[model samples]
Target chain A: MSRLAAKFEELAQSGRKALIPFITAGDPSPGFTVPMMHAMVKAGVDVIELGVPFSDPMADGPVIQRASERALAHKMSLRRTLEIAAEFRKTDQTTPVVLMGYLNPIEAMTYEGFANAAQRADIDGVLTVDLPPEEGQECSALLKARGIDPIFLLAPNSSVDRVKKMDAVGSGYLYYVSLKGVTGAGHLDVADVENKLQQIRANTQLPVAIGFGVKDAETANTIAHLGDGVVIGSALISKIETNLDNPEQAKNEIVELLTSIRQALDCGLGTEGVQE
Target chain B: MTEKYNMPDERGHFGPYGGIFVAETLIPPIQELNAAYQKYLKDPEFIAELDADLKYYVGRPSPLYHAERWSRELGGAQIYLKREDLNHTGSHKINNTVGQALLAKRMGKTRIIAETGAGQHGVATATVAARLGLECVVYMGAVDVARQSLNVYRMKLLGAKVVAVESGSKTLKDALNEALRDWVTNVDNTFYIIGTVAGPHPYPAMVRDFQAIIGREAKQQCLEATGRLPDALVACVGGGSNAIGLFYPFIEDESVKMYGVEAAGDGVATGRHSAPLCAGRPGVLHGNRTYLMADDDGEIIETHSISAGLDYPGVGPEHAWLKDTGRATYVNITDTEALEGFYALTHMEGIIPALESSHAMAYALKLAPTMGKDETLIINLSGRGDKDMQTMAKREGIEL
Candidate 1:
């Protein structure tokens, strides 16, 4: 099995939900990304979503957009991001790294090159933000050929029929955007998220992970029971944004944030896990 | 003729150029929109309603005038102008906006949102939303808001909330980014009325269909007036809607050659122009794969143009496919060349052209001089220069 599948199986055996943390590669700094990935893993993150910074991230709100701008200022590219993931694999081979971002960089690099490089970098999955299944066939096939899972996203507005279509091609997990808005926007109704997850679960056997508007431990815990995983992106990047001057402190702060969410996921404090 | 050449494939691709390259959160909404657009496009009632609005509200069949004096002065091919500048709200933008607004109403959407660089599309969208009693919001770049204050005031008067985007290069691309964010957030209630032939799957195809009226009308007018199709067609390409609007109908007519002029700020050599099809490579930006002004690292670079409407760093996907297939030729006109064309047309023909259209006029002026006097060339006069008066004054050492 792929590392992603194996990790999910391991987590399922432990009766615990996955805690996925996302951070833009080269944000805060390029040199800081590998260390941050290791720190996140040490803090009990099951999957690390390393964002490949694009110049215009239209789907993101201000916070994540700022992160991309900062990262781009350091001259970050998709190639460099894969290098960072490879660097992280030097010490930690068990942890799964999912490259997440818009598709332009990948399109520029060509899908075949990206899939081959990702496999070489030990990257386990890819969640291209802009590439839905309809447009993702070639990329998905390339990734699958390399034994890498091609993940997809499901949104609140996703109809049951849409979910079924996405589920048919999606692998690794289904990233369910918890809100109707861009990343970091507010107004996440927990009940609404639960209801959507129920609908999504009925159509797909793959684990469904909830992202967007997952700000802190409380919300993460609340969302924990509703899905197989919780993805925190803008919220963690906010820590780096607040601590830009001190890379060490930013890493510590992100680790602290992930630790809280991990504890919540493991203990089932906010709500009951599936096994519980 | 293949049925696919005129429109995008089922996946919204024009060759390898266009696709829905948006965030996963937006996929469902985009899919829903594609379905809705496809349904309404085939519905006779929907087409009838759109046609009625285009006729009565937008003032369709904008005159195709023979620029006899201007052609005589140029001393070349007979120059004809498709007077889209006379359309309501003073631009061809309303052609797409009215169609989209009607679609929004039919889709039961209660709100309309759009992005504008020069504020023409914003005003057009606001006008339609007000007519339909729908909530309207327009996102403009902060830089554009400062430059095009007149259109900003006009949109506000039309009862649309205007948001000034301050991110990225703070131009058309930034405003588009902000608008995409808004659409993704408010997918349930809002309809994004894209002003150009860019964006995700249905947008490039849908906007092209809405604006194709320009070509349809011009073809009929040309045959009636001159009794023959023009030897060449010319229009400025920003996000390329107007140019595509004029070029799509004539695509299969091998005798009718097409020219798409882009805004070359200083010149293409200076690396400051917004002529993506002329100088850029293929990449995804705003929702679709298209020709983009990006660097070696795939990061979009800032573009410069005197005309805000033509300042975008990307061209529409279909334009990319057209350029690749050799069906259409893309060229660039310098800001100085366009300014000259602007003055020449205004003084000689008594028609003040928008700076965006001036690029096409500049190219047509060059191409017309090369052809015989018996040959004919048509230019899609995309908009009027009324909105650009401030920019013009600023350039001439005067303040508005």
Candidate 2:
């Protein structure tokens, strides 16, 4: 089994939901990402989704876009992002780090080249925002061949056929975007998300990680009940955005925020891994 | 030449150059749009309505006026101007907007949105939306809003709410990202009228079909006037709508050559330009895979051009496929050369061309002199220079 499979199985065995926290690599500065990854792991994040900064972050809202701009200014790139992941893996080899971003950067670094670099870095998975299954055949196959799970996104409006297709092609958890808007723009309706998750559960067997509006402890805890995991992206980036002038303050805020959500998950989290 | 010149096989790949590469949230909506577009494309009723709108509303079949004076001065091939500049909205942009607006109404959409670089498409979208009594909103780069203020005011007068996008590079691509954001949020009642032959699947093919009216007319006019097809076709390519508009219908004409002029701001060598087809590699951006001006790190480089419309890092996917397949030759013109073409055409033929169109004019000037006098060339004059008077005046050190 792959690291993602083993990790999810371990989470299920412990009856604790996965808490995936996303942060753009090199956001605060070039020296900021490695320390932050260790900090988040210490704060009980199950999976660290490291955002590879691109000049055009179309799927992201203003907060994450700002994070990308800051990261890019430090010359952070796909190669640099992988180097950071490699740095994080030096001492801590158990935690799974998933690289998440747009696909052009990966295209620039050829698929075979990226897969080899990722394997060397011990990266676990990849979630390309704009790469749907229709265009993901080659890239997904390459990642899967190298034991890196290709994570696909399932939206609120995904059809049953698309869900099935994603289930067959995607190896790791499926990210369910709870709302119809860009990341960090709209308030997610729990009822709507719950209803959509039910349909998605009926169609796919891959673990579903709900994101796109997992804002606070309330929203995160609520989302934990609806899916196999909860993802927090812009909300965490917002903390970094607010504390750009002070890296220590930003790290403290991120740790504090993730800790609260971690506690929220532990309090009354649903242990039901896939509906009976 | 034995086979028909069909492209972008059903899945929208112009030989791996175009595909629907968007986030999952946009999948259902774009799929819905594709179904509607496919259904209405051959529908007699839809075609009739679109044709009527083009003829009566947009004043279509725009004249193919021979630029005899300019051709004589060039002392080479005969030059004819396919006068899309004389269209109702003063550009070829209106051709796509009118078709999409009518389609939006039929699809039961109540809100219309668009993104623009030079503001021509914004005004065109707003005009069609106002005619259809739908709410209109346009996204433009903050820099373009200041430079193309006349078209900005024109869009407002047509009842569009103009939003200046203050994001990455703050140009055409940024505006497109903002418009995509808006569409994802309001997919229920909103219809995004993509102004160029770019974006996701159906958009490139659909816009090409609508704007193909230009090539259809120009071909017929050239055949009627000269009793033979023109030897060459030239057009400026920003998102490549105008160029594709004039080239699609002639793709099977083995003897007819095509040239797409890209904006080389300072020079491609100086690394300050948007000549993607001329000096770029294939990459995915703005919902399609195409040639893009990206660094080795895959970050889009900031593109510079005297024409706002052409200052984009990526070109339409079809243009990429055309360049690769050798169906079209892609050339580039610098800001200085395009400006000279603008002035030359204005003085010689009494036709003031848009800075975007002047790129095509510049390339034609070079090629016309290289050809024999008996040969013929047609340049798609995609837009008028009325909106560019201020920029020209600024260049001349005169306060407009």
Candidate 3:
């Protein structure tokens, strides 16, 4: 099995909901990333989504968009992002790292080239936001062939048919965008998410990681009872954006937030353990 | 050749160019939109209402006037103007906006949003929203807002809330990014009227179909006047709507050579131009895989053009397909040459053309002298030059 599948399975065996923290690969500077990855893992992240910043992050809200701008300012490319993942893997190999972003850079690099580079970099999975399964078949097959799980997103509006389509093409886990809006949008209807999760579960046995609206530890705990994993992106990137003048301070803020969310998830999962 | 020139296939692939390359959250909204578009496209009542609006409101069948003097001066091909500049809102943009806004109404969407470059599409979209009493928001790059303040004010007068996006490069592509972000957030009740023949599946094909009225009418008008189809067609391609609008109908007419002109701002050799089909490579941007002005690192380079509309890094995906399949010839016009075309048309024809359209005029200026005078060329005068007065005046050392 791929590292992503193994990580999810290990988390399920431990009766804990996975905490997937996403940070753009070279946000602020290239030097700030590998250390940040270590910090997030130390704070109890089960999976790491290292964002590959694209110039036009169309699906992202203002916060993550700013993060991309910052990353690009530091000359972060997909190749550099993979190098960062490789650097992260030097110290830590057990934690599954998913490279997340748009598909253009990968397209520029060519799918086969990207898959080969990603596999060499010890990257576990990829979640290209703009590549739905319709255009994802060839790239997904390439990634899956290289033992890198091809992750896909399942939205609130996704039909059972769409869910099955995702499940058929996607491996590792299906990312369920828990809101009707872009990443960093803060409108969460737990009841709506729960209803969607029921449909998603009925269609796909692949682990579903819910993202887009999980902000606080309480929300994370609530989500822990509802899904296989919780993804916190803009909330964490907001720390880096807020502390652009101080990278260490931003790192500390990220650690502080993730530590609390980790505690809440561990505590909640111990008591309830994903009430599915 | 609506039957013969069926390029996008059913799934919106103009060969391997256009496809739905958006995030998962957008799939359902676009699918819902596609369903409504498909339903209304086949509905005769919808077609009747659209026709009535086009005829009465937009003043359709914009005349094809022969530029006899200009053609005589060029001393080669007799050139004709399709005169899309005479259309309502001063461009062919209204054709698509009016159609989309009507579809949005049928879909029960209360809000209409759009992105604009030279602000023609913004004004066009705003005009429809005002007519329909729908809430309208227009995203323009901060650079475009500053440059095209006249159209910004026009949009505001049409009751659109103009948002100046201060993002990467601050141009049409940035405005599109902000608009896509807005659409993703407000997909529930909002109708995003993309300004051009780009953006995912239904948009390229749907916008092409709406704008195809330009070609459909021009073809008949050319035949009626000249006793045969024109030998050549030329249009400026900024996200390629105007060009596609003119070229799509002529695809099956193999003898009618088509030219899609792109802005070569400093010249394509300088790498400071927006001629993607001329200089750039294929990559995905703004929900479609198309020819883009991206660097080796896949970062969209800042595009330069005297015309704000043509200052986009990517062209419409179908243009890429057309270029690849050898159905159309794509060329570039420099800012200096385009300015010369702008002045030449103003002097020779007494008709000032939009700077965006000036690119096509520039290409025509070159090609018209080379072809036989008996052969005719129809230049899609896509918009009026009123919006470009400030830039032109500035170039002439006049403050106003």
In model 2, what is the error at residue B110, expressed in angstroms?
0.9
Candidate 3 C-alpha lDDT tens digits along B1-400: 2337667767788878989999887898999989998899999999999999999999998999999999999999999999999999999999999999999999999999999999999999999999999999999999999999999999999899999999888889999998888888888899999989999999999999999999999999999998999999999988999999999888999999999999999999999999999999999998888999998888889999999999999989999998998889999999999999998999998999999999998899899999998999999999999998988888899996
Error of 1 at A148 (Å): 1.3
Model 2, range B98-137, lDDT digits (tens) per residue?
9999889999999999999999999999999999999999
Cand. 3 Cα-lDDT? 0.92
DockQ of candidate 1 against the true complex: 0.70
Q: Per candidate, chain B TM-score? A: 0.98, 0.99, 0.99
Residue A27 lDDT, candidate 1, scale 0-100: 94
Ten consecutive residues with minimal summed lDDT in candidate 3 chain B? B1-10
Worst 10 residues of 1 chain B by lDDT: B1-10
**Model 2 root mean square deviation, Cα atoms:** 2.0
Q: Write down the DockQ of candidate 2.
A: 0.82
- The worst-scoring run of ten residues by lDDT in candidate 1 chain A lies at A267-276
Clashing pairs in 1: A130-B22
What overall lDDT, based on C-alpha atoms, would model 1 receive against the true structure? 0.90
Model 1 residue A40 lDDT? 84
Task: Report the candidate with higher DockQ, 1 versus 3.
Answer: 3
lDDT of 3 by residue, A173-200 (tens): 9999998777888879899999999999
